[model samples]
Each structure stands twice: as structure tokens, then as C-alpha cells.
Target: MTAVQRLRSAAVLSPPLLWTVVFMFVPYSILLVYSFWKTQYPIFVPAFQLGNYMELVRDPQYLRVLLRTLKIAGLVSFFALVLAYPYAYFLVFKVKRPSVRLTLYMAVVAPLWVSYLLRAYTWKTILGTQGVLNSFLVSTGILSEPSSIFLYNQAAMVLTLTYVFIPFMVMPIYAALEKIPPSLKEASADLGENRLATFLKVTLPLSMTGIVAGFTMTFCLAFGDFIAPFLVGGPDGVMIANVIASQFGAALNWPLGSALAVVMLVIVLGIISASDRFERLGAGRLT
Candidate 1:
């Protein structure tokens, strides 16, 4: 390429490249450096060490919390996929009217207009002992009084995360389903394949890209979430993020917090890598 072409390319990339360096790369680099340092009470000592990471490995409580965090994240992703896929399929295949499809899509995305904190707190209210569900059950004689069964548990955390992230799953799957050519199904039928066979072979394979995208997105978000757990995930329901928050907050242990953050980033990146492979495989099948 010509020097002018190179110059033009550099100019076009400069803004985003500078922004990433200043905001993302620099901050992450600082965190990475901090993760190897020691914290002396409120002061951060500049000495390089592996004590923070070593502590993470040595502490059974930290390992348990990490496991619980992964479990909750996996459950949230699975439930979100289960709930979102069918709705997306219905919107793409069953709904005939474009206007109705648009309306339904809007409804699915409408919750994003509200603040996430507000939504999390709203679930807290709905699941509380004296909340709407309990009140309804009591009034209908399903129970003699309001029950504490609904709130402050892993189940409550799962429910709230699933509700919050369902739309993330829905939109991607819908986009993939919408892109599928109607003629492909017709061709399969003309070739003497049954609907179920055609769907399993063609429809599902094509939609895997979106499924992988949605699942990865939801998993990462739910894994990093601290708010839902903080609001409704009582003693038994707390995840690793809560512990990480405490390390950075009241504990004032920056090194430990940075190490934990790095570990989470590594896991999230690994998941994304696997998802990318799945996406590539799906694309290859389509081609």
C-alpha cells in the first residue's frame, strides 16, 4: 500500500486505539501490576509477590465461592436460553404479521429502558415475605400467611438474573432465526425430509451461532453480577463477586481484589474463546 493509504488507515484507527489504551489497557495493566503487590493495611506496598493468588488457591472458602459463582452463572445462562429460544422461535416462525412481530420485539426489549438497580430491587420486593407473591398466595388461601420461601436464596438470585438477562438471549437468537431462508425448509421438505428432521438438521444448526452468542453474553454478565446477589442473595446465596467487592471495600485489600478480578477475566475470556469456536463451526456448516 501507498504511504498515504497507511497514513489514512492510521488516522482512522487512532481515536479508538487511543481510547482503548487510555481507558481499558492502562487500567487493566495497573490492576495486573497491583495483583502481584502486597497490601499493608490501607497502604499498598510496591513489592512484587504471588501472595494474593496464593491465598486464593489456599483458601477453601474462596474456592467454594468461585464454584458457587460458576454454578449460578451456568444456571442463569441455561434458564435464559431455555426461556428465550422458544419465544424467539415463536416470534420468527409462528407470528405472521410484521406489525405484531415488531410489537412483540419491543415488549421483549422494553425492560431495558428501566434502571437495572430498580429492577433488581423490584425483584427484592416481589420476593420478600410480605411481597406480592406471598400476599397473593395468602389471600387465595394457598398459605395461611406470608412465607419467607421466595426471597434471599440462590433460587431468588437465579430467578432475578434469568429475568434480567433473558432479553440478551432473545435478540441474538431472533436475529439468527430471521436470517434463515424460508426456501431452505421448503427444499428439505421437497427432498422428503420430515419437519422434525429438517429442523434438527438445518434450523437448529444455523441457529447455533446465535445460541452460542446469547449464552456467552448471558453467562459473562451473570457471572460478573454483584448487585442481584447483594440485594437478594442472603448469607447462603452470596457469590464470588460479593467477596471480591468486600475485598475492595471494607477489607481494603486491593491486591486480593485485583487477583480475583484477574481470575474472573481469565474465565470469561476462556468461555468467549469456546463460544467463538462454536460460532465458527456453525458458520462452516451453513457455508
Candidate 2:
């Protein structure tokens, strides 16, 4: 390339590159260093050690919390997928009017306009012992008094997370489904394949890219979520993020917290890599 062309290209890329370095790389680099340090009473000692990571594996409480976090993340992803796929499919395919489809799509994602804390607290209010659901049930003669079944549990955590992230699952899947060529479906029909068969063979496989993206995103967000648990998830819903927060908060163990944060970051990166691999394979097969 010519000097002028190269300079223009560099100018276009430099802002984003600098933004990433300053906002993303630098913070993560600091966290990486902090993770290796040791914590003495009242302070973190600058030294290389694997003690924090070791404790994560060695301690049963941390292990349990990690496993529970995984379980909740998985559940939230699954439920979000179940709810999102049909809605997205309807928006992309079933809905006939363009205006109507656009409106409906906006409705699904409109909750995002509201504050996340408000959304979480909305669920808490609905699920709490004397909250909306309980009041309705009691008033309807379904129950003698307000019940506590809906809040303060792992199930509540999963439900809250699923509701919050369903829009994340929907948007990508809607875009993927919209991108699908009608000729592919027409060709499948011409070959005497039924709608269900064609979808199973052609549509679903083609949409795997979006599915993987949404699943990976929802899982990662749900896995790291601490606020929803604080608002709606009680004792049983404590996840790895909560544990990590405790270390940084009242526990005052920065090294251990940093180590936990690093581990979570690594896991998320691993998931993203796997999702990319799957997307490449799916694309290659479709091609």
C-alpha cells in the first residue's frame, strides 16, 4: 500500500486499538498481576504464588459455589434459548407484517431500556413472601397466605437471569434467521421434505452460529452475575461471583478475589473460543 493509504488506515484503526488497550488490556493485565500476589493481614503482599488458585480447588465451599454457578448459568442459558428461539423465529418468519414484526421485536427487548436493578427488583417484588404473586394467589383463594416458594433460591436465580438475558439470545437469533435464504427452504420443499424435516436439516444447522453466540453470551453473563442473586437469590443462590465479591469486600482479601476473577475470565475466554470453533465448523459444513 502507498504511504498515504497506510496512514489513513492507521488513523481509522488507532482510536479503537487505543481504546482497547486503555480500557480492556490494561485492567486485565493489572488483575493478572494481582492474582499472583499473596495477601498478608491488612494488606496484599507483592509476590508470586499459586495459593489462591490452589485454595479455590482445595476448599469445598469454593468448589461447591463454582459448581452451583455453572449449574445456574447452564439452566439460564437453556431456558433463555427455549424462550428466545420461538420468539425470534416468529419475528423472522411467522410474522407477516414488517411493521408488526419490528414492533414485537422491540417489545421483547424494551425491558433493557429500564434499569437492570429495577428489573431485578421487579422480580424480587413479585416473588417475595407478601409480593404480587402471593397476593394474587391469596386473593384468588388459591392459598391461605402468601408463600415463599418463588424467591431466595437457586431456581429464582435461574429464572431471573433467564428473563434478563432472553433479549440477548433473541437479537442474534433473529438476525441469523432473517439472513437465511428462502431458496434453501424452497429447494428443500421441492425435494418433497416436510417443514419440520427441512427445519431440522437446514434451518437449525444454519442458525447454529447465532445459537452458539447467544448461548455463550447468556452463560457468561449469568455465570458472573452477583446483583440478581443479591436481590432475588437468597442463601441457596450464592454463586462464585458472590464468593469473589466477599473476598474483595468485607473479607478484604484482594489477592484471592483477583485470583477468582482471573479464573472466571479464563473460563469465559475458553467458552468464547469453543463457540468460535463451533461457528467455523458450522459455516464450513454449510458451505
Candidate 3:
């Protein structure tokens, strides 16, 4: 390439490359280094050690928390997929009016405009003993008094996460569903395939890309979230993220926190990698 052309290309890429290195790579590298160090009360001893990771493996509490986090994340992803797929299909296939579709899409995405903290707290209020739901149930004579069963539990955590992340799942699936040509479905029908068979074979397979994307996104976000759990998770809802937050906060164990963070990052990356592989395989099969 000519010098001028090379200079122009470099100019185009430099800003993003620099931004990534400065913001993303550098912070991650520092966290990795911190993970290997030891914390002595208020002081961080800059010495390499695997003690943090060892403790993570040996401690049953840590393992349980990690497992719990994974389970909740998986559940959130599954539920999101179940709820989002049909809505997306309805938007793409059933909604005939362009203005109506656009309005519906905006409605689905509208929750994102509100603060996440506000949303979490809203759920907390709804699930509380004296909350609207409990009051409604009591007033209906379904219950003699308000119940404490709804708030501060794993169910609450899962419900909140699913509600919050549903839009993420919906948008991707909608995009994928919209991209599917109507001609393909018509062709399938012409070939003597029923609507159900055509959808199962063609529509569903084609939308797997969006499903995978949504699942990965929701799983990672849910797994790493500490705020929702703190708000509504109560004792049973506590996940690895809560533990990690404790290590960084009142625990003041920076090295341990960094180690936990690193481990979580590794797990998330592993999931993404597996999902990418599965996506590739599905795409190949479809083609």
C-alpha cells in the first residue's frame, strides 16, 4: 500500500485501538496483577501467590455461591429465551402494520430508559410484605394478611433479572426473525411442509443466532450482577457476585476480590466461546 493510503487507514483505526488499550486492556491487566498479590489488612503486598484461588477451591461457601450464581444465570437465560422468542415472532410475523410494529418495538425497549436501580427497587417494593401485590391479595380475601413469601428470595432475584434482561433477548430475536424472508416460508409450504414443520425446521433454526446472542448476554449480565441480588435476593438470593462485592467492600481484601473477579471473567469468556462454537455449528447445519 502507498504511504498516504496507509496513513489514512492508521488514522481511522487509531482512536478505537487506543481507546480499547487504555480503557479495557490496561484495567484488565491491572486486575490480573492484583489477583496474584496478597492483602495484609489495609496494605496490599505485591507478591505473587495462588492462595486466593486455592481458598476459592477449598472453601465450600465460595463453591456454593459460584454454583448458585451459575444456576440463577442459566435460569434467567432460559426464561428470557422462552418469553422473548414468541414475542419476537409475533412482532415479525404477526404484526402487519409498520407503525404498530415500531410502537411495539419501542415499548419493549422502553424499560431500558429507566434507571436499573429504580427498576430493581420497584420490584423490591412490589414483593415486600406491605407491597401492592400482597395488599391486593389480602383485600381480595385470598389471604388473611400480607405474606412475606415473595420478597428477598432466589425466586425474586430470578424474576427481577428476567424482567430486566427480557428486552435484550427480545431485540436480538426480533432482528433475526425480521431478517427471515417471507418467500422461504412460502416455499416450504409449497413443498408440502406444514406451518409447524416449516417453523421447526427453517424459522427456528434461522433464529438460533439471535437466541444464542441473547442467552449469552443475559447469562453474563445476570451472573455478574450484585445489585439485583442485594436488593431482592435476601439470604437465599446471595450469589458469587455478592461475595465478590463483600471482598472488595467491607472485607477490604483486594487481592481476593480481584481473584474472584478474574475467575468470573474466565467463566464468562468460556461460556461465550462455547456459545460461539455452537452458533457456528448450527449455522453450518442450516446452510
* Best candidate according to lDDT: 1
* Tens digit per residue, CA lDDT, model 2, 42-67: 78789998998898889898888888
What lDDT does candidate 2 reach at residue 284? 19
**Model 1 Cα lDDT, one tens digit per residue, 114-174:** 8899999999999999999999999999999899989999999999999998899999999
RMSD of 2: 1.5
* Candidate 1 residue pairs in backbone clash: none
Please list the residue runs of candidate 2 whose C-alpha ends up more than 4 Å from where it truly belongs after superposition.
284-287
lDDT value, candidate 1, whole model: 0.92
- Model 3: runs farther than 4 Å from truth? none
Q: Which order, best to worst by lDDT?
A: 1, 3, 2
Error of 2 at 14 (Å): 1.7
Model 1 CA deviation exceeding 4 Å by range: 284-287
What are the per-model numbers of colliding residue pairs? Answer: 0, 0, 0
